[model samples]
Target chain A: MSDTPMEAAPFAEKAPDAPVRVLSEGLASWLLVSPLAILLAIFLVIPISVIVTVSFWGYNEWDFYPDFTFENYEYLLTSAVTFDTYVKTFSYVLMAWAFTAAIGFAVAYFLAFHVRSTVWQVALFLVCTVPFWTSNIIRMISWIPFLGRNGLANEVLLQAGLIETPLEFLLFSDFAVVLAFVHLYTLFMVVPIFNSMMRIDRSLIEAARDNGASPFQILTNVILPLSKPGLMIGSIFVVTLVMGDFITVRFMSGSQSASVGRIIQNEIALLQYPAAAASAVVLLITVLIMIAVMLRLVDIRKEL
Target chain B: MDRTETKGVSRRALLKGTAAVGAAAVGSGVIGAPMIWAQNIKDVTLRQFGTGVSNLNEVAEKVKEDLGFTLQMTALDSDSVTQRAATQPKSFDIADIEYWICKKVWGAGNLQAMDVSRIENYDKIVGIFKSGKLTPESTIAQGTAPHSVGFVPEPGARAFADEQTNWMTLIPTIYNADTLGIRPDLIGRPINNWSELLNPEFKGKASILDISAIGIMDMAMVCESMGEIQYGDKGNMTQEEIDKTIAIFIEAKRAGQFRAFWKSFDESVNLMASGEVVIQSMWSPAITAVKSKGIPCVYQPLEEGYRSWGGGLGLSANLSGLELDAAYEYINWYLSGWVGGFLMRQGYYSAVPETSKLFMSENEWGYWFEGKEATEVITNPQGSPMAQVGEVRDGGSFEERMGRVACWNAVMDENKYMVRKWNEFIAA
Candidate 1:
């Protein structure tokens, strides 16, 4: 109550001057950020706007044309297939996010807290990214030799008398698809979280310990709250990537799986340009909504 | 990547090529006229784009050797080939593409009518591209028969004729009767009908191609054989027909009947070679490739017949004058024996059967065309033994296979709807 009265007294005195001060402050910051805004306008904004314009155009088998129509959007909304595809794509996002976040947090926690020497921590962290040096297609393909029908995993399982028949789900299955997603995107999650974790003050842990807080209690109460920003940033990277990916799912699932990107690709291949553009626009909006929700959950700008 | 094999007339060197040809024309007024034409032709280059099945570097080298002009080949997948053919006219001088794709590209007017009179072996070309029949008794099968679009009624005509004429759209190159390929040693049973592909017994041991335009045809064949859905025309399926066909496959896919769907030749080869799949919708050369690895693979003929697709060369609308003459020269040389014989060794039938027969040995002709047991081992164009001494070709004679073509790969009037349904199947 004492703090509220003091805050209200200062705010009441400064009310007349507040609007002018905030306007000038915002303008200065906006000027500082203008270059990046202009860059985005040229590359990202212009291309996406073009796609948006095309989304409302009419098309047939031969070609697309300049005419306003809502048929593409109507077709998408009415079809059960589109909704099912969205759900499947969402499932992929959830699976990838879960695996990537858990694995990324553990790895980053080990590097930031467990390792004593800074040089060794850097070396070990770099070692975690060794797989990134090769082509993604190569890395995904390399799984086939190990997870195939008569591959190493099956042969080992069979030799151990685990089962009579080989495991069919080892490759070209949902399991394989999710495995590849985690293998590819874990680094995306790890880096941001690691940066945030490294910037965390060490005295907080000491302070908790001196107050008779147990290690687990300290972890839950102190470290977890402080790491929210890193976790949020990492989750955003993983969620957007998994939601947009078609290649990893396509290759790993052997064309048996579907993504919104794959649908857009198939339409483009058949020269259904307007339909592809419409799907792209819808996907863009859906991803933006997801990011907005993530932002609302954690004030990322303030944390950064 | 494109390989340009030549006397070095690159894409930008066309003007120089015409100048060289003009110089040769002037030199042709001298004693050694044929020598001058041959020498100057080396400076001319023609760019050709097609599917990898036909646009071999070997064919380009052979053209350079025989026709005295450079032939640059760019190999792309079927859809990309169609896209380039329809939208990019100046990008290529010749398009070796499928007939169904021809329907799409023809409307764009990117290709011009090729003269049947210019192709020397035109009459000797197969009846399928001329009369729409392999023999007198042969009824033209369903789908876009090459003969339907092979000719135009007039010179520089953009529209395809219903019947044959002197003004041709494409000079036929290679075609085949495609069917399911099976690893016979793995199955240890005679699998004959198309219905066997989705049989519960082979559950998790079967696959189909993932290409929608072609894959749907195979699905229609399977659905008909299984007595699930009946279609009046498999190639140009109605909207209801497509729905039923896709639904049936989606059910089968959900039941785990498929090991994996293949999108490329190498993937099909890998599936068969690794013993991951026992039966699948397959291309001819993929079977040959598997057999070349000493694996027991067969392009098995089913009781329901085969789904066929054919590809040929179409001239770009941009060609005229001496460059056009050089292209005509290349087409004539293509129909001549050696290239046909080379392609025949790789499991594709030549357009001019009689000329190709001249290039093959008696044993090869008997084994490949006549379906006789091989007295000697048969080698592919790469000189690798594809079949052992006593083995007969899997689907029997060319007459036996070609006579039974059930349908051709197609792009229907309802192509957009069909593609949407196809995507729905994949998503399902």
Candidate 2:
């Protein structure tokens, strides 16, 4: 194969030394990137391509076929249930993101500004991350005993005469699902925000104080603006995680709820691979658009 | 938290180390075919793949000692087992799966038919399974179409070509009925029918399983009991039946009649023990678990009869020659004596009950099989004290329970329709 492009020939002929150096640099860059490129192709690109190809295939009750058909996509697009399920899934994502961001921001702020000692800050930040030590499934299940009808929350309330009747909507409702999601995913929000908050110039806060700005005003004008990149990154994480979740919703809502991911899971369970693949593709596109919007709102590159 | 991060880092490092070693091995041709081929062919490690039901490590150890071949058992969930069997048959040598998976897997040509002549204990399986019909009355009465005969003979088998097929689809293993579990203290009355799961009095206290296939079947039974609809066959519902059943489910769910829909056995137990649900669909083990916590719960015997299921061992289509012979030996060993007795102690019935008797003592047989009051304290499969001297099995005897099986678990023709509707119901 020809090593040089046709348009570059004039430059290469004028400076043969430059062409040799350029070729060597190009080879080094290719060698450096080949391992990561190969990994990405194998793990991400190949699997996504397979899913997309499978989404176009046909399937009957017994098995999937290689025939190209739009029936899977048609069914998904036309169904009323599909729209409703997506709306419900997005509601979960929105709620989870809001709660996680609020909780994560508060915790990160406390560690960065309120805690004076470095050792104390590190130790306390680790404490906020204590739940991450357990598996997601275990963490979700632990809530059952704490929030069930005869669980600690209910019994304590009843004993103290806080209410006339025991609350029946604690364990297996929308409340429990949202609770579990917040508990499991807030860590994603905390780490990025904490990293951003730690990098903020302490002198900026001192300057704001000298200018007679209130704590809330300083937070609103300076700290919030500086932390937008971290907040955007955290939001992307929470949104994608909540949107793609199936197990937490399945277990916590006691199967009373369905996310888009859960719908895909249902199709796979029924041996309907084409339909599942189509649903998965739809979710992937939706998540990508959301992330694109979030990235557009904040230029993380400048901040980093 | 720091410990977890360090542990994660170490795990990643271990994975990278493994990848490096693998790359080196490939570069040096150390894992080449000649090296693999040089080993004794009969010394092959038979890969036993199935759900946790069949992945008893103790049994695998016993098989290895007796047969002088490694039996490597890989446990997966139901969906994953079917997925692997359907897409990658050669990854496993023998498959121990439920009977319902046979039709789908066999139709895909992923499973091979067992030669009845080779299985030494083949003749000893209970007559009910071999015949597929326990009695004339036991046949499904709702369906006009000829019901699917349970023991399916494979293509090109001698029995299928020459005479009535003795070539079985699955060598029968353990089986049991699943029904409603109820908290006795809360109900304040005897609940005897499947309709009680939907009783208005129990609204906000009842739950069902989350699995679409099994959950729909349980709901179908509830519908049939309530005179809401009639089914041609509950196991294989038509599209219209599935739609109607799920619509009813949606209406009920919207009305706030259910507390939750459980996905796992432990979740079901937790629901019962914590008194979140007073009534729900449950497995036998879950019922045992609730009671073990000193909570008053029962695996209620419903008047509509029980939804039953069975599983067994099948050879993969890829295995042949020495590996095939070894698979046959393992299947025979599963039904021989010890494994059956082991499973029977866990409240499941073995195909050859008589063979299981060879391994059990008189007191154990009297308690587990005969359903007599325990003359002495009886231990469960885990050797925990499950019952005192006067306790009895919930449905009476093994024969009484198995004989009352109304329908076997099936992969319905309308599974796609059911799944779609089930999702709608959950969303609604």
Candidate of highest DockQ: 1
Off by over 4 Å in 2: A1-39, A115-123, A198-213, B1-44, B65-68, B135-164
Task: Label model 2 with its docking quality class.
Answer: acceptable
Alpha carbon lDDT of residue A18, candidate 1?
62
Q: Candidate 2 lDDT, tens digit per residue, B293-365?
A: 8888988888888888777887788888778766776676677777888877777788888889987877778
Q: For candidate 2, what TM-score does chain B get against the true chain B?
A: 0.84
DockQ (Cα-based) per candidate?
A: 0.54, 0.43
Clashing residue pairs in candidate 1 (N, C-alpha, C atoms within 3 angstroms): none
lDDT of 1 by residue, B1-428 (tens): 24564434575476655665664454333212243254456667899999999999999886665555788999998878877887789999999999989987787888989877767788889899999999999998988888888889997677888888889988899999999999999999998899999999889889999888899999989999999987888989999999889888889989999888888889999989999899999999999888878899989999999999888998999998778888887777778777888888888899987878878988888888889999898988788998789999988999999999999888788887888888888888
- Considering chain A alone, report the TM-score of candidate 1 relative to the true chain A: 0.88
